[model samples]
Target: MSIIVQEQTGLFHLQSSGMSYIFQIVEGYPVHVYWGNRLKHREPMSDLLIHTPKKAGLDRLPQEYPQYGSGDFRNPAYQAELEDGTRITELKYAGYRIIKGKPSLTGFPAVYVEDEAEADTLELELVDAYSGLQVVLSYSIFSDRNAIVRSARLVNEGDKKLRLRRALSASVDFQGTRDFEITYLTGAWAREGNITRKPLHQGETRFDSKRGMSGHQFNPFAALVTPQTTEYQGDAYGFSLVYSGGFEASAEVDSFGSTRFNIGVNSFDFAWLLTPGESFQTPETVMVYSGQGLGELSRTYHRLYRTRLCRGKYRDQERPILVNNWEATYFNFNADKLVSIAEEGAKLGIELFVLDDGWFGKRDSDNSSLGDWVEDRRKLPGGLADVAGRINRLGLKFGLWVEPEMISPDSELYRKHPDWCLHVPGRRRSEARWQLVLDYTRQEVRDYIYDSLSAIFSSVPVSYVKWDMNRCLTEIGSAELPPERQSETAHRYVLGVYELLERITTAFPDILFESCCSGGGRFDPGMLYYMPQTWTSDNTDAVERLKIQYGTSLVYPASAIGAHVSAVPNHQVGRMTPLEFRGDVAMSGNFGYELDLTKFTEEEKEIVKRQVAAYKEIRGLVQKGDLYRLKSPFEGNESAWMFVSENKEEALVYHFQVMAVPHPPQRYLRLAGLHPELEYEVQSGDSEDKPIIGGDRLMHLGLPLAYEQKDYESGWFRIRAVNPGKA
Candidate 1:
């Protein structure tokens, strides 16, 4: 049996007459490889040979090359690495046999030497193709040393426009219904429940109780189960990303015995229509392997997702915990007011000061102006940068908020360019908040937004952008595109918005970008491509946020949320709570204070002072920590969770009292992490009272319930046990 292996790991590589590597299964899972080496510039064949894994029936595979019977080419330079550690850098068209890399397809274990041969013996057969309406059968193999992962491109070289539905189904000859779990990092971790038992394992299982069947689809994991073809008559199907191919990785995972795997996407999905030789492109990939369990498979999958597929193209940076002022001061604060809040914020360790909506346009409040990206002159005598500079000079970074795709009817942009709105040019245009949506699908729209933002960033010391999308698709239709192209509106709108963001980010790679569509509306991997973090929601109430934040964190890292301590009588839900309760709730996230700080009474201000102090002391521990929910919101009267840093040096626990209970014995709480054999002293965050306790106190004795929660009040107990050595 022969296998193929490629050892080079370049972000992008150029090639002639071949598909690019979108997803490469290295050992047993897939890894991402940027394959667009400046298009049209091909490279000399490197000693790169892609390898196949080793298995029983698939051991002795012959090296095979595709014979071009349909096209006029004697031979194409093929690359492969054999099951042994040797690489095959050249290929000659033989009769019908091609060596199997990893049995990417099922049938053959040997690399084929045939130029062209009968279809029966081969595991995968290219059944049909022409004008982008392509279909085929495939297998997942990883048993050969030197092999060929397939790559196919269907160009729209026909005369009339054609409608097409494309599908590629895998018919792996597995012994039985292969058992595998399909997990997704979607819905956030459950907010309210009894602390869940540690999953039988950590890295393998999803933290949520909500599980679905299908196969883990990537981060937005979903099994491509049975693919269905869509029919298209005109431009609706003009362009498609439908293509598929196959390949395998080294049998044993690098320097380690575990196998690493990657898949190629030059071929496998999408249906496209062609018009008189106009071309449409589709990419594909298929991978197969025999593995012990998902643990190995997941390790391979995660690396590929992060290294290659995460296209935002930025190194991992600590996501900023920003507080937008719109929700805090509304459109009412002046430069001095803004400055005062920021100064207090900085003293409390806030990182960035964001100016939200109503800071632009010819008016005030949420109703008047959106399309106007200019800094509101009435709001501040100086420009936007002046305020940003003020915040920056105050030892904090500055962030600006923009609703680029929205325009209010009362604004200048709509009055001058009514045609740019989404409705029919004649019929009543839909208006919410007396605002119309921008035609982000158009290039002109993108250019205008790009230049305006570029000018702002250039003029100020801006380091972050709170990219917010407030509304969903209300008025669906668009008069701009042709009738057949209307369905492309939503998808294209998203993609176009992404394109504009992509351009902006490329231009200003240093600026951190965040995406929020009314809080999690566009919360998918697609948006994460450009914006690393997102505003978790419009709801900031501590009680309500317990679930929202918990659910959101299950899939996204904790840093993604723009959490803050809003004023009591919660803005969204008018329930007033203590300031301490509010701060403790927001502390678990990218902590920041949002309420107008100066308005508080002297007593309230002191609480604010202590709250800020608490955050400062534990911010690092909270930011870089492992979260374990000690009590699930659903199963208990109260919610309790603990945050432990990567190092066991520090720990903070948040216990929220949801109900009134009778005073009982000593308060006992069984904690998840602590040295089972070590002893240390424990005390409340503010109290100097000493209570030298042992792990047994936390694990066996547990803290008893002694007090009841005030109707709207909450409790936060910070625990720091002295390390025995340090003591």
Candidate 2:
């Protein structure tokens, strides 16, 4: 069993091969004992808990799920108000049960186990006798991964109403803080997922998003690590909220230098009213402990999320090489123009052609016709069926883009039901990209979207759907929600989106869905639960993607990133890059193209053909292999990364140079994650010369990089073990 409980000592220990989380019930409160490298179970393990004099109180002791107004002066995991307006409540340990398998959070996305033996869950119950509020803290430890999934459930067992003001998912109190540093991802629009790191300080350092959607500004993730920690070594603790809506993750250092880390739904402008017998479940937060370092922590998350968190028919399948017409034509293409692009894509080995924006209503630009899902007769005289059929006949799958969550005032749907959008009774309704957010909190609104999208999916042979939301939420109000429940609008709106996604994805099991919120805005674990992959970013500039994709790979798997090659001067950054460099960058993820294939020259067309073929040959390895980042783009002008298969039989290495220098010093790039005893053969891009070397020498001595004269030069290498049995 992964979970072991010492009944006599009231201690519980959750263990994985690489880590352990231990806590004990003292007097009445559950005190955090230790969370770090794994330790053998013993009777004396209970001694690890520090016991202070009664007068010292919990302020000096570590707590598990600490509550406000209790003895603890630090931040609490949750806070609530009673019917009498009292906010103070003390909870005492009740009882706990060991469950065979992890239980799913009601109406929330979380990691799951296919078999009962894959994980063990411990449910620790605490009760506030004064208010009859029961809080159940669940901790599930995976048998094969160095991670723990934590969540809390608040049940109003009393006859009165309970208003929760702050409810966070998980919290941990680390004994010392001065030695720790915080690492998180932050950026804007086209530059999402820029890694930021800083030393831990006296006050709280927070990462949050209050823009309704998980804004592109800050991701819902944070990590506390030793200052000496590097990508390949040192202890690291990572926390990630499995939510796509507004969220908060923070690290607070008390005067005593103890750090309390918490992560969950943003408590800002948030509240939930729980009536008698009603329960509120917080979103799950994944906690990973890596004594081996950040790289192992990331690999654990990559393997777990790719195999367990993401679910669908396409979860384990090799994604199709697609060509989206957004950058190619934007809002200006007709049926003939689309069919021509699809023909060109098919000739160059692209498997799918996506028709993006402007095919519906009278949509010529981003200004109008968003709510109407019907095709415009002027753009496609024969509707979706005709174009899809043409593309299908040319041996390419057909894809369509839709922004189902937005409504343009000029559209017929919005005109018919102006009240359908989220708006206050008297406040002005804000418009972004000339569109308003639909009130998903209303069943009718969700039904309307589902029906509209269902009609298109049923009528056409759509192989994929690029579900996009172009703007962050504003004027957050819902007509269907009562005044007392208005504070719940944002969370309910996210739930409604999930409800609609569940219905559609479950209904059409064969169609592939790619979630996009202006690009990487909504790229989160919650969205990945329904859609296995996400459009990495709207920016197709290869040079800019070095930082974006590199930072993103810190947590997200390559299989879940939708990367595409685009035309030069790139539409987003207007920086011209070599076609080969663009292809190399895009091939590191789910490969695709977002350009007008018909406009390519004969030579460029041949290059694209070879790029497509090369991606096909390595797509399996690239998507499923373990990634080892050799060089970071943030550290220097050059970047290098590689992927090694699970069995260590095959590997692919990619290196990029942003700018060239004259007479640079000789440097050899050392590789990692290979069997030292095995002999391997390495082959550079399209080169006839093959070199055989031992895996030990490849990792220790490294490979020599060929110097190039121009900027934006990139290359890839393929490696295969020559003696598999010997290794």
Candidate 3:
């Protein structure tokens, strides 16, 4: 049984395929005790729960969902103001149940189970009797993985209204104050998702996104680890919020010397006013504990999110290799130019041709015609259908780019209804990229966007859509909503985005959707839940992508990263890298091209052909296989990564040297995820004949790599099992 309840001890032990989470009810209050490697047997909790020098009302005790009114002094996961206007909360376990399958989150995107046999969820109902606020804490254990998903649902069963100031999704309490460190992702627009690690001090270490959108400043992820944790050993706990709005996650050491971690919606400018019978469901939080190190921790997240969190027809399918015309011609292409580029692309084996930004209504530049979905006949003399049909005739699929979340003041739609934009009267509207945000909270606005998309899809033969949001929210006010509900604008806007995505994606299941926000500004689990992949970053330079891709792999999978080889002097970074290195780096993700094929030399054209063929051959393995981070770019001048097939039959390794070093020694890469007893054959571009080696020696002793002493150099290798053995 995945979930076991001990009635006598009031202990609930939830076990996934490889880990366990145990919590027990003490004096009608659920207290968190252990979460780590699975325990083979249950032990007595009398000694575990005993705390000397107790504070008032057990507030010092470690709890699953700590409350304010209780004796615990640390930050409470649940907090609210009662009728008397005092913020105090005290909840006791009221009831519980082991359900057959995982429940879904209403009005938000979350992981789902297709069958009851896939997972089992344990729901514990807790209630604060004085305020009549009921919180249902849920823990879902996967039938075949070592990860557990957690979320909370708050119900206002009281007669009077309650204003919730803080309601986090999950909190974990660790018994020891062992030396620990926190690892998270942080960077700017073009340079995003760089991994940073620092010692976890006694106070609080927090990471959040309050920029209305999940801005490029921080990804919605955090990790707590002991000092001894490494790539393959020690303990590492990862926390990722399946949300894209403003959120907060922190790890704190309280006065009692216990480490507490919490993650949920940002309470900093957040207040939910709940009336009678209204329930609020927090977004899901996925927690994974890896005793084997940070690499295993990442693989766990990658596997879980790839299978359960992401849903669509393309979720498990191999994505096509497309050429985007954004950097090729920017916003100055006509239908004839697009068709000519598509013709050249088809000749080079590209599968799709994407018509980016400028194809829409008078959008020759970023300044005007947003929120106007009509095709600009000036740019595309032939309408969208004619261009799409021409591209189809060239033996390639057609894709269109759209920025449905922003509207320009110069647009026809904005002139018709200026109130449709998110603005408050008497306040100057702020614009980013020369565009203001559409008030998504308004049903009419959402309907208009949806209908516009539907009409386009129905008129054209588009097989893909690059959904973009170029700006963050500012001047946060909605003309349609009253002043009392002004604080709800951020959360409501995200929900409205989800509604539009759900409606359109569901209506066109076959269309491959890719999320973008001026590169990867809005990349998060919430977006991946709707779209299978996201543009990794606007910095397409191969040298820069090494760090970006490496940092992103700490949480996201290869299938969720969109990488492309662009022309050098790269558009964003202006770095001139070799075409081969560019292709090598892009092959680590959903491979594509962002360069002009019409301008390529004959030699460069041949290289593109070979790259297309190579990527198509191994894309299945890279997309679905187990990924291993060989070396981090953050730690050194080189970056290396590998992907191993699930059956341990094949492996692909990528090695990159960011800068050339004087008198550098040969590098040895230790392979992962191979059967130690089996024999494997290895091959590379420089090797004359395939060499066979024992997987045990290859992993323990490592394999030596030979490369040129040049900046921005790369090497690729493939290994196949020669003898079958259990992994």
List the candidate numbers ranked by TM-score, top first: 2, 3, 1
Off by over 4 Å in 1: 1-127, 130-323, 346-349, 424-427, 474-483, 647-649, 663-668, 673-683, 687-709, 712-727
Query: How high a TM-score does candidate 2 get?
Result: 0.99
lDDT of 1 at 407: 77
lDDT per prediction? 0.47, 0.92, 0.88
Total backbone collisions, model 1: 126
Question: Which candidate achieves the best TM-score against the true structure?
Answer: 2
| lDDT of the structure predicted as candidate 3 | 0.88
Candidates in order, TM-scores: namely 0.62, 0.99, 0.98
Q: Over the stretch 112-223, how does candidate 2's per-residue lDDT look in tens digits?
A: 9999899999999999999999999999999889999999999999999999998999999988544799988999999998999999888898889999998899988888
* Tens-digit per-residue lDDT, 1-727, candidate 1: 1112232432123122222222222332222232211123233233332344454211111111121223312221121122232322221211122333222212111112212221112222221222222222222222221111233333333334543222112111111122222222333211211112221111222221111110011122221110121111100000001110111111111111111111211111222333444432222232211121222222222222223223443324444444567666887778888888788777655677777776777657778777778887777878887888888889888887788878788888777887776665556766666677777768887788889889988888888787876554445446577765564454345446657876888788878887766665444434554665566666788877776666444334454555788887888888777777777778887676667765668787778668766776776666545565566554556666676654444567777765566653455566755555656555565768756667657756765544553654455556566765442
Off by over 4 Å in 3: 43-57, 686-688, 725-727
Error of 1 at 72 (Å): 36
Which TM-score value belongs to model 3? 0.98
- Model 1 alpha-carbon miss at residue 391, Å: 3.6
> 378, model 1: CA deviation in Å?
1.9
